[model samples]
Target: MANIEQSASAFLQSRRSVPAKMLGLPVPDRAALMPLLTAGLRVPDHGKLEPWRLLVLEKAAMTRLAALAVTRAGELGLDAEKAVKGSAQFETGNLAVVVISSPKPSDKIPLSEQVYSAGAVCLSLLNAALAAGWGANWLSGWPSHDREFLARGLGLHDTETVAGIIHIGTAQNSPPDRPRPDVAARVEWVSA
Candidate 1:
């Protein structure tokens, strides 16, 4: 048990996301991705209401979505820089998993909690891919938040929102380690 705990701690401490732009080919196929998806689904749920679903976007889908993002940006009269930033991920991505936050009508569980669970799934999926020796990153840009883009490109319902898009592929380069937060400054202990 101690060994298991120590291993988990070590993995968590060292886990870092590879940049989406740095990710390249040899993405995980459906067979290889299934286990990662399974691990992602093991997040906490207060009411057992699984308020999340995944949309796997392959190369073709990524291209289509990139076009849609550009079109949507045009319709919204966004600047060229914003439009480019919005579509860049899809344009270069070989494969991505869209974690959709599909909230259910529930009396007991709050909507915020359901949304949080979806976010947890996104992190879990990203971590699982990294652990499996794949480069992975979680991202959401203006395209993810635009209603028109979500409706047309992803077929998202009114109650559904983009939790995150986890891009997975072979890493083109290793990034230098960035500064981490000061844990002591962020933590507060309470004893009664």
Candidate 2:
């Protein structure tokens, strides 16, 4: 790697969310996106059970998702504004990948582990996009949590839940860095 990090902390500190709206045109093609997806799949899996699956939503699919959100919101008797907001991410995205937490049957491997693996995949996808010189954001809205929306809109099974919608595109502007968490306040020194 040409720009290799000298430290682990530096590697993590470099990661940040680039506003999806600030992203420009010309998203990654299928061939380019495949490697990113593959990289995301390489996450921690207890018992070697890959519990996460992704749905790559392009421009056309985004329109469908937005349309579905509008219709489903009416069915659920939610506010029009909320409905529109929920779908806006999809409608405006250059490209998106839906990380689904597909918890499968496993008596030994805990369900929590499966859910975590899915979350890990979400982070992996987001980081991969940033590393590839693309702006990416992991997001979720009311539609993701709503049962009708997932079923009627995204066609997600009951066993599957949407973890996040990973938006990817070329960054239009430089992102302003935000405040970091107070690590000292959050940490506790454990001495035996």
Clashing pairs in 1: none
- Cand. 1 Cα-lDDT: 0.95
Error of 1 at 152 (Å): 0.3
Tell me model 2's lDDT, rounded to 2 decimals: 0.88
Please report the TM-score between candidate 2 and the true structure: 0.93
**Residue-level lDDT tens digits of model 1 in 65-178:** 999988998999999999999999999999999999999999999999999999999999999999898999999999999888999999999889999999999999996689
Clashing pairs in 2: none
| Alpha-carbon TM-score of each model against the true structure | 0.97, 0.93
lDDT of 2 by residue, 1-192 (tens): 445645435657878888877876889999989989999999999998888889998899888988888888888888979988987887888799999999989999999999999999999989888888788889999989998888877789999999998999988889888999999999999998
Per TM-score, the best of the predicted structures is 1
By summed lDDT, the worst window of 10 consecutive residues in model 2 runs over 1-10
Worst 10 residues of 1 by lDDT: 170-179
